[model samples]
Target: MGRGQLVRQRVLVPLFGDVRGRVISWSSAGACGFKGTRRGTPFAAQTAAGNAIRTVVDQGMQQAEVMIKGPGLGRDAALRAIRRSGILLSFIRDWKCVESRADSKRLYYGRFILAPLMKGQADTIGIAMRRALLGEIEGTCITRAKSEKIPHEYSTIIGIQESVHEILMNLKEIVLRSNLYGTRNVSICIKGPGHVTAQDIILPPSVEIVDNTQHIANLTEPINLCIELQIERNRGYRIKTPNNFQDGSYPIDAVFMPVRNANHSIHSYVNGNEKQEILFLEIWTNGSLTPKEALHDASRNLID
Candidate 1:
C-alpha cells in the first residue's frame, strides 16, 4: 500500500476479549503512527479515541461498554472522547493490577459503576454548591469587658452614644472586609448605661438597635452591660468614615482581623458580679477564608 493509503487506513481500535466472546473494538495512538513517547500523549489518545468512536458509530454501534485496564496517559482522554461522541455509553470500568497470593500474576481489581450524564446538571450543581458555601453559612464572635471605657470620652452622654455608634458601625463594615458577604441590617442592643440608651445609639440607616428600653445608670454605681449585635449576611461593603476622623483608622490586626474568617459559632457570657463584663457577637458562614487569610486580604485591601 502507498504511504498515504496506509496512513489513511490506520487501525485506531483493536478490540480483545475472551476467545469465546465477540470482540467490539479498540484503538491506540501508536497504531496511528505516533512513535515511542508521543503515543502516550493526551493529544494522540484524543485523536485515536475520536477516530475509533466515529468508526463504531458508522458500524451502527449505538452504545459502548468499555473496560479500561491500563494506567495510561490516554485513559482520561479516551473516556472524554467517548462521552463527547454521539454514541450512548453503557458503562466505563477502571481495571487495576493487584498481586494475588494464590498466583504471582497480578489480577484486575476494582469496581466500576455506570453513571449516566444528563445535560446541564454539572453546571447547576457547581453554582448551587458555591452559593451554599459562601453565602448561606454564618459565623460569630463575642467581645467582653468589665467596663470598657469609651475610646475618647465626650462632654455629654449623647457624645458617648454617638462615638459608640460610629465605632460599632465601623465593625459592621469590618465584617464585610472579608469580601464573602454584605450585611443589610446590623442589630445593636446596649443594656447598661442611660447615656448609652437605645435612642441615643445612632447608627447607619441599615443598622437597628433591637432593644428600645432605657436603663438609666445610677451615679453611685458603675454601669454594667450586655451588648448584642447581629450582622445580616449579604455582600461586601465600602468602609465609610466621618469627616472629622478622616485621617485616623483602627489597627487592622486589632480590629479587622477578628472580623475575618470568623463565620463559625461563637458564644460568651460573663456574670454581672464578675470582675469583667463581656461583649458577644456571632458570625455564620460556610467555610470560605481562614481568619489569617481574611486578615491578610483585609490588610492588602487597605494598602491598595
Candidate 2:
C-alpha cells in the first residue's frame, strides 16, 4: 500500500444477539490487544465503544472498520461519533445468526396468488406524454434510464432518478453543451421565477432535459456553473419566531428545525493550473431573487 493509504481499526458492538461478558471488544492492529468494560448499559456501551476506537486511532490510525451486531440504538450512534472525529471507516459487517426448522408451512399474499391481469386499460398518461416527448428528441441524443417498465410504476421512477445522480444535473448538462467554461468565465442571470426552490432540493426524481432558450438561456460570455457544498449536522438555521395567541402566554413544547445543505465543491482547472479560487455569497429574501444579485457581484469580483 502507498504511504498515505488509510489504515483500519474495527469497533464491533452488538445491535442484538447472544449474551456477552462485556459491552465491547476492543481490538488494534499495530499493537494487538483487547479491553473489557463491566457495564452493558447504553451509555456505557457508547463510552466503551468510543474509547476502543480512540485507542486504535490515538496510537496513529487513519481509518476504522466497524462491525455492528446488536439490537441496541447506541451501536450505530457510537460509530457515527467515531467517524465524525476524523477517522475514515473502511467497512461495516453485520454478523447475524439465523436458525431454521424443517416443520413449517409457507404462504403467499392473495394478490401474489393471482397472477397480475395486464389486459386492463393501463395508465397511459405518463407513458403517452413520454412517447410524444421522446419523439421530439428523435435520435438527437436520447437516453433511457431503464430498458423496460415494471407492473408497479414506482420501480421505473427510481431507475430514471439514477440517470442524473447529482443535485443539478440539468444545469451541468447545459454548461457542458455551451462549452461555457472552455475558453472564458460564464455568468447565468435567472429571473421570471416566483420563488426558487431550496438549493438542496433543486433536482427531481425523474429524467429531465436541458435546452438553451427553453430550460436555460445561452450566454455570449463564458458560462461558469458553480456548485458549492456545505453541511450542518444539527441543521438549526432559522429566521423568525412564532408569537403566542393570548398576549404572550408561552408553553414549553415549541421548537424550530434546522435546514440541511448539499455536499458540493466548486472546482476549476483553468488552463491546467488547477488552483482557481471561488467566492461564495448567500442572501435571503421574502419575494425576490436576492441571492442571484449577490452571486452576480461575487462572480464579477473573482473572474472579471
| Candidate achieving the largest TM-score | 1
In TM-score terms, candidate 2 sits at 0.23
Question: In model 2, how many backbone clashes occur?
Answer: 12
Task: After the best TM-score superposition of candidate 2, give how far the Cα of residue 283 lies from its true spot, in angstroms.
Answer: 61
Q: Which digits, one per residue and each the tens of the lDDT, describe model 1 over residues 1-304?
A: 1000010011223242221234434456765678765865778868877866665666666655554434445667766786787656555543222221211111111111111212232233224323333333333211111123434322223323344444444333332222223432223344444444344433455433333343223222244443333343333322433332312222111122222222221123334543221111112222233322222223222211
Task: Please give, for residues 1-304, the per-residue lDDT of candidate 2 as tens digits.
Answer: 1011111112233221111212222522112222333333445545655656555545565654454433345555566666766766565543222321212111111100111101210122123222322222111111111112222212322312222223222322221111111122122222322222232113222311222222322223333222221111111222222342222211112111110111111223344533332212122211111222222222222211
The segments of candidate 2 whose C-alpha lies over 4 angstroms from its true place after superposition are: 1-38, 98-304
lDDT of 2 at 303: 16
**Cα RMSD (Å) per model?**
23.0, 26.6
**Among all windows of ten consecutive residues in candidate 1, which has the lowest summed lDDT?**
1-10
Q: List lDDT for all candidates, in order.
A: 0.36, 0.27
Highest lDDT, which number? 1
